[model samples]
Structures are given as C-alpha cells and as structure tokens.
Target: MLIHGLLAGSLALSGTPATTAQAKIDCAEVKCLALTFDDGPGKSTAKLLRILKKERAKATFFLTGKYVDQRPALAKRTLAEGHAIGNHTYSHFSLTPRLDDEIFDDIKAGQQAIKKATGLTATMFRPPFGHTDERVLRIADELDLAEVKWTGTTHDWALKDKKKIKAKVLSLAKRDGIILMHDTVPQTVQAMPEVIRELKKRGYHLVTVPQLYSGKLRSGVSYP
Candidate 1:
C-alpha cells in the first residue's frame, strides 16, 4: 500500500483528461513487473482493486467496451488509483482471423468507451484472446497504441483453483515481465495476495504497463 499512501500524499487528481491525470511512476533500478488484466471492469474488479491497494501494486486493465459500459465507476477507479488502461476490443473478439476494418472498429470503440468511462485514453492495446497478426499490428500502429503481450499467463480464466493460479503466476514471475491475467475471475482475485507477496519478497517492483515500458513504448511493439 506504499504507492497508495504516496498517491494520497501527492497532488490530488480527478477524473480529467489523461494528460492531466496520469501519474508518473518512478521505478528506476528496480525489477519491474506489469500485471495486466483483460476482459475486465467486471463484478470481481473492485475486489482486485482492493488486493492491488493492499499490495501497493500498480496494474493495467485491458477493458472491453461492454464491460466498461456495465461498470463505468470501476473503470474510473482503476485510472484514479494510478493504474493504466488498455483496449481489449469492444466484444473480446479474436482479431487475427477477422477482417481488418472490423478489427479497427472494435479497437476504436473500446478506446472511446474507455475515455467515456474513465476520462482517459488507452495508449495500449491487447488483442482479444491474444490473437494478432500483421493487420492487427497495423491498426494498433495507426491508432498510436502500443500492442502489449504477456510473458506469462496464469490461465485464471480457464482454471478455477486459486492455488493453481498462484502457483502458475509465481512460477513464471520474472523481471520486466508482463503477466496476463483476468479481473473477471474470482479465484484469480483471491490468488493475488500470495502472488504479490511472494513477488515482492523476491524484489519485484510491480508497476503499470506504461511504467514497465518507462513511457518509451514503441508503436506496434509487443511487450513481454
């Protein structure tokens, strides 16, 4: 909760444009990890927020348009808590096998939905189902959003056991790694504390997606 305390002691930020509201993360010389949750702003998201706060960790949420529409306040809170937001498309549709124009529209819709819900723009995009090709990269490049991929996945969406989720994530935790997870899963939410504590014990400075990239993310680059 150190970052949360730091956030309170620092300047007050409101739900404003991203340029004015984004927090500057300082993680120089630290082993940074980017915890990214996809298909979220869901029923279990608030609990995830509490866990992140308890861990004093910053994470990134790749939200779908409809989920943001369902829980706008959660989306806003995610940004307000000094976390980053990214587009996961409007319908969580797989993009690689889809039409290029359709993929573009979905990404745009998700971006607009995020801005509407959080008063911040998504500077990153995670392809739904982690399916991407040259066309997906092109669309992301055109939108000026960095394409973020993960180095490890907890498989929390398919796995129902919290212990397994914790084990998978902890086993794969590494420096400068982006972890793919989901906020919609309750077990994953439950597994967070242990995973965070162990990672912290090992000296990882959990950070947001942009913080992991130090704001120098290359366009169309798939960060791990």
Candidate 2:
C-alpha cells in the first residue's frame, strides 16, 4: 500500500467543517460503527480482510481505481468477502486545486472500475488527500453519491503509536459511526487487532458501510 505519490494525504481535507458526531447515533439498536479503510485494497488489504473476518466485522474499502486496475482479483474479493467498495478516485491525485472536469472524470473512472471489478456501483466517495472542493461534492451529489465525512479518525497513516491510535479510536468511535483508518500504514494495521477487541468488549457490533446506512439506525444518507 505504498501510496507512492500521495504520502502527504491524510490531513483530513482542508477547511472541512468541524466533524459531526456519530457518537449520538441510535445504531438501529445494533450498536456498532462502520469502519472504513481508505487508499487501498492494496497488498496489505487481504491480510486486513482476514483480520476483519476473524472478528466477524465487515467494513468499507475506498480504493483508488488505478490500484484496482492492478489488483482486480483483490477488488472482486473485497465484495465477495462481504465488505463494501467506495470510490477513492482513479490515479488518485490531490483533490486540492480541484478542477471540475478532472474531478468528474476521476469519480466516473472509479465508479466504472468498481462496477467492473465488483459488479456493484457505489454511492460513496472519499476525496484524495481529503482535499475536495465544491466541484467534487457537487458531482458526487449529482451522481447520487453521498459525501461521507468521518467523525473519528486514527491518524494511523502518520505512523502514530499503536497504543495512542487505539486510544483515539476507542475514545471517538460510536454506534452507526464511520471510523477512518488506513491500510496504507503498517502501524494502523497493527493497532486494529486491539481496536476490534476493545470495541467488541464494549459491546459494539461491527458492520459494513452499506449495512450502516440501511439498518434501522438513522444514517446521514438514504439507502439504495
């Protein structure tokens, strides 16, 4: 999951509004959050998927179309394994200095690739470097995609300490919440075992992004 060029990615989209709390959600009475791993269905992704399966937790994977181009089987496996795929754009460049034309094309390519790889179309997108503008949001909305803004983030891509990352994760995670972590970082992957264990100990039930949106819990966006 070497992002190659986008290493400077995870600053949480410049100028984003203060995060909305997913903590207060009713959770459809299921009481778990939607865990998301972005920037990949990369080399590390299969291992991550195995870990999640062991925990009986499903998550959303926002993968870049270019990466999927090379890892077609992994992309298909992501869906087959019961996780969700979200658009993370094709040839994922920084979304800053966002141009409407490129943004639209990026999203479309991602959609096409996901459909081709997984036989499903996604209605969610995570902007590269979290640096999206109105043009990006507008296209996503126009295309009926929901712009998901996560409330809890692990900052794991920064190689933060595993214990500290887990603490941040536990402190912020909530029912029907969207928890952001990355498969691109080794440290993040290391911290996941503990994070899953803790959440389950606390009685949380992990579910995929689609399930998060479709269940009795009141999600921010409408379901298919």
| Candidate with maximal TM-score | 1
Q: What RMSD value applies to candidate 2?
A: 10.4
RMSD of each: 5.9, 10.4
Instruction: For candidate 2, write residues 65-123 as lDDT tens digits.
Output: 98888888998887776666788888788765757787788888988888888777776
Candidate 1, 21-140: lDDT as tens digits = 224545465567778898988899999999877656767889999899999999889878777788898999889888889988989999899989977767788998789888899889
Weakest 10 consecutive residues, lDDT, candidate 2?
Answer: 1-10
lDDT of each: 0.78, 0.68
By TM-score, how accurate is candidate 2? 0.79
lDDT (C-alpha) at residue 23 in model 2? 24
Badly placed stretches (over 4 Å) of model 2 are: 1-26, 215-224
lDDT of model 2, residue 64: 89
Query: What does candidate 1 score on TM?
Result: 0.87
In order of listing, the candidates' clash counts read: 0, 2
In candidate 2, position 84 carries an lDDT of 67
